[model samples]
Target: MWTLVLNCGSSSVKFALLDVQGGQVRLSGLAERLGSAGASARVEVDGARRVVDLAGGSYAEAFAVIAGALDELGVRAQVGAVGHRVVHGGERFSAPALITPEVLAEIRACVPLAPLHNPANIAGIEAAQAAFPDAAHVAVFDTAFHQSMPEVAFRYAVPGDWYRQHGVRRYGFHGTSHAFVAVRAADLLGRPLSELNLVTAHLGNGCSVCAVQGGRSVDTSMGLTPLEGLVMGTRSGDVDPGLHDYIARQAGLSLSEITAALNRESGLLGLSGLSNDMRELEEAAGRGHAGARLALDVFVHRLAKQMAGMAAAMGRVDGLVFTGGIGENSAWVRGAVLARLAVLGARVDEAANAAAVRGQSGVISAPGALAALVVNTNEELMIAQQTQTLLAEQKGVQA
Candidate 1:
């Protein structure tokens, strides 16, 4: 069956059409700069790639362009279903679901918790349903995998009525990525997931750490929002609660201004005074760029400390899986984190770590090194699988 996976952001949409029969992606692309001038769609099919200037105005038009291209390519395979990567489930959805009008409205209502993501995700789902009325549309939430978190872990130490009424609790993000990587790591290690305890570090533009025990998420670093985790490309991860009030009083900055700064102008960009891209920062650091060096150091330090804490929480971290753009590609960052982790028996094989750059899954740990790995995460595939599973269940229910 053919499954099309859609991940929509504020102004961009990423799409992939996967052929589950052979477990291959038939086509993948990104519609960048949507709702802005000079929007374009970059797509690759069978190793052939092309970037086309989009005349479309909004996400709907952009998707229409993509569909037209797929038609041109003669990819006539019937799409069995479409899967969406939704950022928040808000305790309502515990697994992937068939999108109904009520389900779409619930996802829309979650826009407050994910102002920059949920609306776009909802838009994509609506567009797909409009474009392909026959194909079932599924939503696989990023917060779903962490739904296993117990009340003690997910609850905030606040007023009782607040959480009891307002849903004021932890809802970890990056669930799909963490879930995909941890399962793959277990498989690569040739072990049953139930027998493994894993700490998955998803480091990218947005980052988070997950404590996976018995193949289920026991804890995660990212709290209610993506803005709460490890230092990211632009977002400040963890911060002192008092700093907000102090900054407002001292700098005369409004709450919204500070929020914008923390969510958009901080992290690697703020620390490095250069760029948020790790590759650029790494190169600059190599040239004795003080700010860049400091940025890299801080990133690695916080990551190691977080992983160490996750290990403590899990009681025993039998596996460490690193995924995401930086985690899967940056050997220097991985080595630095692992080196600091020697305190927890997490040692790395420098050679294996370096060789892992080509996106191969392997143990980057020394022979005696306590379980460490570099696994490339395929969140789209996970979404597709969830979609297929849910669609099958729907069919069974109807049958």
Candidate 2:
């Protein structure tokens, strides 16, 4: 069976057609810069690449282009199911769900929790459902894998009524990536996932850490929303809850303005007063840019601190697995984080750390150190697997 995975962002759509039986991507593409000048679509299959203009297009139009590309590649007929990546499942979904009208309504209800993501996800889901009505449609939630978290870890310290009434509590994101890497980390260590404890860090534009025990998420850094995690490219990670009120009173900033600043203008960009890209900050830091140096320092510090917290959650950290763009590629960042974790007996082989770049996965830990590794996260593949499982279950029920 072939599963078509669609990851819809605010302004871009990433897609992959995977052969679930063999775990291979038959085709992949991206449609980006929607509703803006130079909107475009690019597709690659069988080692061939093609790009087409989709200027000033919408998600619906983008999907139309993607469908055309699939047709051109001659794989449209092979797609047996369409898997949609829904960012927030709240406390409702613990696994991938077969999409129906009720399922779509539930997804729509999550828009408030993931205002910036769930709506886009719903748009993609609606578009795909319409485009491929004959095929099974599945909703693979990013929060589903973290739904196993115990109440002690997920509940806030605030009023119980707030959580009970408004559904306000820690619902970790990047669950699919965390779940994927935990299993992969176990495989790399030649151990069963059920036997190992791991602290998995996903460092990219958005960053979060997870503590996994016996293949289940015990604790995670992100809470309620993605804005609560480790410092990210443009999002402020952990700030005092009172800071919002203080800024509002002192600076006369509106709630929306404060939110915009935290979600867009802050983080490395706000701290460095420069680019948010880690590569750019690293280069600037090398040139003795104080802001860039400070930004990197703060990021590494927060990352190490949060990772230590995750380790505490697991009681004993058997291994540390790094994934995402920064985690996999930034040797400097990884080395610095590990250095701060020396008290935990975490030590990385300097040469190995430097060599594990550009998507290469390996054990970067020094001999006898507690298994620090670099693992590439395959979220699309994970979604495909979940979708396939759900579809098979649906078929069995029908039979």
Candidate 3:
């Protein structure tokens, strides 16, 4: 059976078609800069990439174009299911779910928590469902796996009524990626997941640290929204609540305005006054750019600090797994982050660390290093697995 996975953002959609029999990606692509004149699509198949120019259009149009392309290429193989990466499933969805009308409605209602994300997520899922109506639809939430967190970890120290009535809590983001890497780490180590403890750091444009104890998420960074985690490419993580009011009064900015700045205009780009891409910042820092140097230092500082705390949360780390773009390819970033964890025996073999760059996955630590690993995150594959599981479960019920 094949599964098509979709992760939709505010202005872009990423897709992958996987042949789940062997867990391989048969095709993948992105429709980026959508809803704008500069919109375009890039598809990769058979290890070759082709870019298609797509003018300003809706996600439904993009979906149609993709489906039409697949048909034209005579690659319209029947799919067993479609999995969507919904950003917020609230407290209701604790696992990947086959989408019913009621499930779709619940996703739609959670838009208030993910104002910029859930709408696009729903659009992508609906479009894919329409495009492949015969296929089962599954909602694999980015928030679902982290729902296992304890109340003490997930709760905010706010009024109980606010949490009870407003759904206020720490619903960590990057849960899908963290869950993917943690399981992979356990697999690579040849240990049953329930016997392992892990600190998985997902460092991308957005970052988060997840403490996976016994294969379940015990705690995680990011709270209620993606903006509350570790320092991101442009998001300020863990800022004082009073700063919001203070900045609002001082700058005459509203709460939303402050949030926009933190989520969209801060992080490395804001700190370095250069770029959000870590590669760009690394290059700039190498050129003796003061802000860029400081930005990298600060980024690594916060990232490693959070990793240590997460390790502590798990009591001891069976493995420290790093994933996401920067974590996978940036040896310097990984080395710097690991350097700060020497106290925990997190020693990286420099040679192994360097070789792990460029998407290679392996042990980057010394022979006796207590905990360290580089695992390329495969959220699409994880979503595909979940889709297959749900489909198989449905089949069993019918049987």
Candidate 4:
């Protein structure tokens, strides 16, 4: 069986075709810069890469081109199911769900919570449904895993009416990535995930840390939105709530303008005034660039701080798992973070840390210390697995 996975964003759609039986990515592609003149898709089929120009910026246009490409490449006909990555499922869904009309409406209701993501998700789902009309469609939510969070961890210290009338509480993101890496971390330690307590740090362009207590998300850094997490490529993590009103009064900026900057122009980019890419910043810092050095320092410090808090939430740190782009490739980052985690008994083994870069996975912690692991994340595969389980549980041929 094959699962076609779609992770749609405001300006792009990432699609993948995976074989569940063999656990292979038969096709992977990204259609980016949608709603722009430079719209295009870069696809890799069976390990060969190619690029194709798209007709327009609309989701329909991009997916249409992709569908045609899939047909030409002879990969479309084998899709047994379709899995859509819905960013925010709110309190409605705790697992992958078959997309029914009522379920679609529930996803629509979450648009307000994820104005920039859920609508694009809906768009991709609709377009994929049109493209693979005969296949079973499942919605895998990014917030579903975090639903296990207790009220004390997820609720905010605000007015009761705020949460009662509107959905204004901590709804952590990056559920798929966290869930994927936690299982991998358990595998590395040769332990059952349900018997281990780990802190999973997903360090990518968008970053978040999860407190996995017994394979369940007990708490997470990203709250309500991706912007609330660790210092990301362009998103500030843990800013003072009063800063919004303070910036408005002092900087003469509107609420939306301030938010836009925080979501787009902040984080390592804002701190360094250079690039958000960690590799570039590291190079600049090595050249004694003060801003770049400061950015890296703040990133390491803030990330470790969040990791410590998450470890505290779990009450024990069996393993500190790192995944995503930076987590998988940056040995400097992994070592720096572990140095700060000494209080939790995390001591980095230099050779193991250095050897774990560039997609390599290993135990980087010193002997008799809190285990530090580097695990590669595969959200698309996890989505496919969830979609497969949901489809298997259905009666007759779900497609």
TM value for model 4: 0.97
**Poorest lDDT segment (10 consecutive residues) of candidate 1:** 68-77
Residues 1-399, candidate 4, lDDT per residue (tens digit)? 678889999899999888877788878899999989898889988798889887666788877876776787687777889999999999879898999889999999999999989999998888888878998899999999999999999999999999888988898988999999999888889999899999999999999999999889999998878789789999988799999999999999999999999999999999999989999999999999998999999999999999999989978889999999999999999999999999999999999999998889879998998999999899999999999988787855655
What lDDT is reached at residue 111 by model 2? 91
Segments of candidate 3 deviating more than 4 angstroms: none
What residue runs in model 1 are displaced by over 4 Å at the alpha carbon? Answer: none
Candidate 2: list runs displaced more than 4 Å.
none
lDDT of each: 0.89, 0.92, 0.88, 0.91
Global lDDT for candidate 4? 0.91
Question: Over 4 Å off in model 4, which ranges?
Answer: 396-399
lDDT of 3 by residue, 76-174 (tens): 667767889999999999998889999999999899999989999988888888888887889999999899999989999999998999999999878
Task: Give per-residue lDDT, candidate 4, residue 131.
Answer: 77
lDDT score for residue 229 of model 4: 70
Best by lDDT: 2
What is candidate 1's lDDT per residue for 177-232, written digit by digit as tens?
99999889999999999999999999999999999999899888998888886899
Each model's TM-score, in the order given? 0.98, 0.98, 0.97, 0.97
Please report the TM-score between candidate 2 and the true structure.
Answer: 0.98
Query: How well does model 2 score by local distance difference test?
Result: 0.92
Residue 392, candidate 3: alpha-carbon lDDT = 90
